[model samples]
Target: MTRSISLIPSGFPFLDKKWGGIYRGGSYLVIGPRKSGRTLLALQFASECAKSSEVCLYFTNMRPKDLMIQAASLNFDIQSYMNHNLLVVVRIASPSEIYDVPNPDDYLAEYLHDIVAVVNQYKPNRIVFDELTPYIGFRNIDYLNDVFLKTLEEVEDKNINSFFIIGEPATQKAQLIVDTLRHSVTGSILLKKKAEQLAGQFYGGTVIISPNVGHTEGQFTADYIIEPYKGISVEPTIMKTFTRNDSESEERLPELSKIFKPITKIKHENIDDMQMNFSNIYSIEDFHLIINNQIALFKSTGQEFHLVSLKLDSSAILKGLITLNQLKNSVGKSVQKKDKICIVENTILVLIAKTNAHLLNEIIKKIRINLPSRDEVYVKAVTEFIKIYTLEISNSFNNSAELIELILSEEATNAHLTLSELT
Candidate 1:
């Protein structure tokens, strides 16, 4: 007698039709570089699996709160599933934390034990270990192979579909570990960033490697875009040509300018106070004037600016000008001299001039790390009281007024803008 295989849909109908979803009792690898949408794809899969009434476990190296916020920004209702006990998110220590330990191996062993305990307790139908890089970095090749094989066996025995995510290895030893582990997985998905000449935009592409699935005779590849209020969706217009020698092919698609209105120049008077005060935080009204002027400048020139919004919840203990000043001091250290800060009610806005996604991410990380802790009474970090959102304003906008209106709408709705949405 032969055992029947079970299939779990990836939530996206297109992916299900193309790849036939993921196989239960199988282990898969998801590899990607920074800024790729690998994490979003995995979250979408987990959400879909949970919707089908299957228990799913997600073990992540990021803070659970931060991960929840990211999911919310992508319109993934993971909290509902968690409420019903269909989804469980477990937080694991980051690589820096693991490396700081006196005995890294001992710390990893304890965490492994904890993971096994959680898996046994939940008996989840699906599991995702988002990032095995830290674990692989600490152990030798033989040890890594042993542990990874054991993990595969456990998942197979439990009949759980698992996804092991990792970034592109940086070191030779790390690459070796990834290579050894790749041979043991049932399938692998690779995500890459494709840069386009039109407005220097970046798009994500996915390559699926498996014996069971393909769009044509060779490897399966697809272009994807991340949209606001929606997750990842396939871009059908862009065609990817694979050569016989597997060399890069150049092909031009329809320009984005054809889809959106052409960029127009705007004229505005230079505000005297724009360069007057760098240390002082402005009011929301001043923020409007300054940001509008900056946008006008961006329209005339090709310079870009990033608008960052930090909102505090009503339940937060920290409030008033004191907290705002503390936040400004903390954030001021990380930003450049050209950047400006504003505060209104519970929202704080920062206008950063001339920056890209990677640098912006680093700035945000620095701000989060430098955020001050509250007094003994509150005994909480400032990050606990606030949420951050970023929007990159480029030459794609029709006018400054329209862009400002969108920002106002997003602030009113408490909706956060992500890098993928604007880029």
Candidate 2:
């Protein structure tokens, strides 16, 4: 009987698959902006490997301790792999601590020496160097390339697989990493923070891996939020498609969403995730702002508003933040008092909370009669929008409050609408 082994992706659609085939055995690198989530991404890949084999050497210089802590917190079962004699971890404070970068031959010799020693001693299937970039400095790109090419020559079919991480991309190294992966291993992945976007607010993004890892045929993205449903997880971004060589019945890619979170928490404290808290508001502005933010956050997390509620504080028409004429502009001319309504879409989205929702019935009674046809149409549309989305007008903060609280920060972050996005 002949034995056939096929590469099977974990089918974690919420991750990026830069390398089409898993890093079977060879040196690799991941480069991007600082705190761009390169380490976490590397850990995720390691965790995937830990599931199958033994001995995954995780060597690091910068944040080795923290990386282990984070992996442990995520409940990484490293000990099992350790017991299986499948993993080994080595840390180098800096390349100089281990080898001389000035001498290309020495650097390659050291890299090959240390890795082969670990593989020989432990017989691990994988070896990870988290801070490979520092070992090969900025002054010499060719030195890094030599280390990579020589390291690739060292990997064999029955030998250890490899992975590494780099930080703060420069055009040179980024290209080098890509070139090495193209010729050396199954693939490579890039982890980085997308630049912040200015839309009347300061925002920071979530971690992401390009599905198009090293020019391989795959793509994926995800956005995330701290929703009650998913504690502290990377939001699921949409994925394009996964490609494997022929004989692959189905292709699966890993991906995560890109999200822009608020810089401050001061304003976010007031916002909660329940539908009832904002159920009494009648202000179209607040409604638009809240709803819009929720949608964006959801998109960032790559999720839908499974539960939502919105209300208006029409007290403005009575107290005059908006006059009857302005109301007409919103609703329309054919509407009559107590009988008019309107619903405008493609605008802001906010979860409206008010001191009193019962009062709205009375306020609404007045519009039903005098509302013009246009105003009535808009009001009805808005009502229907709420209804269509399964949004409820809750009387209390009973169920689904945490889910609403989950999205509060996202809404408040961009609470004030930017004219650019609105236009």
Candidate 3:
């Protein structure tokens, strides 16, 4: 019996889309505007979860005792939950109290040490630190980022979820918090007002994420919702593209084919276009290694100058940049044929030779016949990889200084032929 396993956790669109399942294990941030009930929401969630014998720790930099008061207002049973020690409510003097005194950076260092120590000792499944903005204000957002990264290192499993709440008009400082945790936390929920209904009497709250609104135009969107609870109905729930699965993620979106056409070419540009001087004869260089090896055989053993470029499109090269070392080695005998050169235009190009060119070509023709219908398989892969592009460029382009170099490299691959300015 065999099965496919998803390394990603599913069902929660907001967190699932972002951290996949890491938030369940590590930490997360739930951010919204003032009076948006961010704290109330986090407490309600932590309390309700505590009932299931899940140990949680709610560390408050402000009023740890006021949790009962806040919970009472929200109709949450946090007091009873606190009584059983199922939840630990630690009231630090200030959010900054957890850190060292005098020097703000020193405070951050001490605060992170305390946090890690507490989390390790309790090993709680859920941890909620009421508001990080205050701490961030005392020190700096950059320092907070390091704290968050260190905090994530302590996270070991998924069933455990951490919620870090922040009140936001989305300040640069607050944005730094959002951006930092967006990476370290499992998922991020950006709460925004969709629109006002009944002349602004009621409004909708929307949750936007990066991967969900990610489209091919190199545009990533912030998707969310707006609602008045019972009065105003927001279409598509209030989710844009999130890491978690809210109630609305039940229905599946249409297949990739319905949205975008599949790409036939994976690498369209010639090496010359990549600034390689193919015109100038070179003896030994990394780019020419493959051709040089072949040319050497033809020179030393008097083999033919069999130079050929095979057009392997996206499907054939989806595994590009990712080495198929073992897979390629398995087919060594298949690819090593004398007096043969193949050109592939579509992705799945296989040329069989010695005497079976006719048969191989016939088989390939049949596969191409089914290409247009199955184009979506390629489109979806490329789409998800769109987010990974930054990582890919960093790994691939050594010459380029920043992400723009990678963008240019990918664009170079897409454009194939360039203008005089590039020259």
Candidate 4:
């Protein structure tokens, strides 16, 4: 008979949406490089479980006092949980502190025994082993396996959910240790710095190496940012796009249409007969309608077009460095009559029809030349001050909203143009 496993919230919207929460009694491995926010993620999970009245045991090398303070800094109410007996913080000594003692193996064995004893006493519904690296390095593979297996068996017997946080392996022995533990766990998550540059900065991402509940085959990755009060927040747009299954494409249209429902429902009587005016700057709502029509036309005819965005620093405008009219005029003079301009917040969205990347760069250069700057010093800092992001819209995109969302997310940087680099 198949075993029935309960489910618990992951405390993250993106993760919960992707996997429908995690298995109640399952154990997972969360591996990441130093400062990649692995501990914070695990802490967030434990805190959320505690909030729901589930008992949680958090084991870490740091002092319990210090760990509680750190959790509070991230706005996690760890102290309240502790007061109510919903959360227990255990302090495990660092390997360096215990390795110097006589019969260090005996000390390690005693530590594992105490932890198991505590679990049997408290019967926590969730457990976390933070930074298992020190123990992995303290003993041989056999001893390490013995310690890990002992704890895993206890948790499994009690049907307790667990998370084992470890640093990315830097040596062969460490890799072997991690690999062995990985197979025994129900699933694994890898957090690391993004390899590619996004907006001139390397962002962090979380990859579901093996999910226990849903879509277990293919890997899913999502970008994330760490904040003081928020802990780790995943970018919802990228997560929604990347983690969506291909089979659900048919159901996604109506949901995507709702993103721009207000703009689409507007009645424009002579939209088709509208004269082309390159110098005219359109509002955000009108621009949305035009882009939607353009995208629909491309879907039916298979013709491609380019969407370029000139993102300006709002601080520059407030500081009297440049005026919106001056920037719009500069951009207007560079494009042909077929191109359309839309002002969205601090960005100027341009629709370039029947254009290629080479010609796009030429137009960008002309716009840069037309921009009014005080002197050569200001001209040299144009690239540093402003950003140019471009995306080529093709039949691959389902709707205009999706394309516009991708551009707004700043992920469509395949053909980004730097103003200073342009001759």
Q: Which candidate's lDDT is highest?
A: 4
Maximum-TM-score candidate: 1
TM-score: model 3 vs. ground truth: 0.43
- Give all TM-scores, in the order shown: 0.55, 0.44, 0.43, 0.52
Stretches of model 4 off by over 4 angstroms after superposition: 1-3, 97-106, 194-203, 212-218, 240-423
Q: Which ten residues in a row have the lowest lDDT in candidate 4?
A: 253-262
- Ten contiguous residues minimizing lDDT sum, candidate 3: 256-265
Tens-digit lDDT track of model 4 for 1-423: 566876668765556676677877888888887656677788888878898899988877755434543464356656566778888876665544464568665555555556677788778998887766655553466776777778888888888888888777766556776777776787777776565544333236654445544444434567787655456778767763433354533211000011100000111111011123454567777777888888888888867788888877765454334445557777888888778888777778899888888998899878877766433334554445467888888667877788788887756544555566554
Q: Please list the C-alpha lDDT of all candidates, in the order they appear.
A: 0.60, 0.41, 0.41, 0.66
C-alpha positional error of residue 290 in candidate 2 after TM-score superposition, expressed in Å: 59
Residue-wise C-alpha lDDT for candidate 1, range 192-291, written one tens digit per residue: 6556422123345554443322223333466776543355666656635343246654221111111111111111111111122456466667777887
lDDT of 3 by residue, 1-423 (tens): 433323333223343334443324545566666434456556655764576677877766544324433453334455556667687765544432343346656555555557667777777877777665454442365676777677666654334567776655334544545555566664454555544532243334544433322211221124333221111122443234422344445222111111111111111111110111212222223323444454445445644331211222343223331112211221222343332221212211121222243543343334333221222322232222211111121122223133223333555345432111111
lDDT ranking, high to low: 4, 1, 3, 2
Query: Over 4 Å off in model 3, which ranges?
Result: 1-23, 62-66, 95-102, 138-143, 157-159, 169-174, 193-204, 209-423
Q: Is candidate 1 or candidate 3 better by lDDT?
A: 1
lDDT tens digits, residue span 110-154, model 2:
654565555566556666666555444423546556665666566
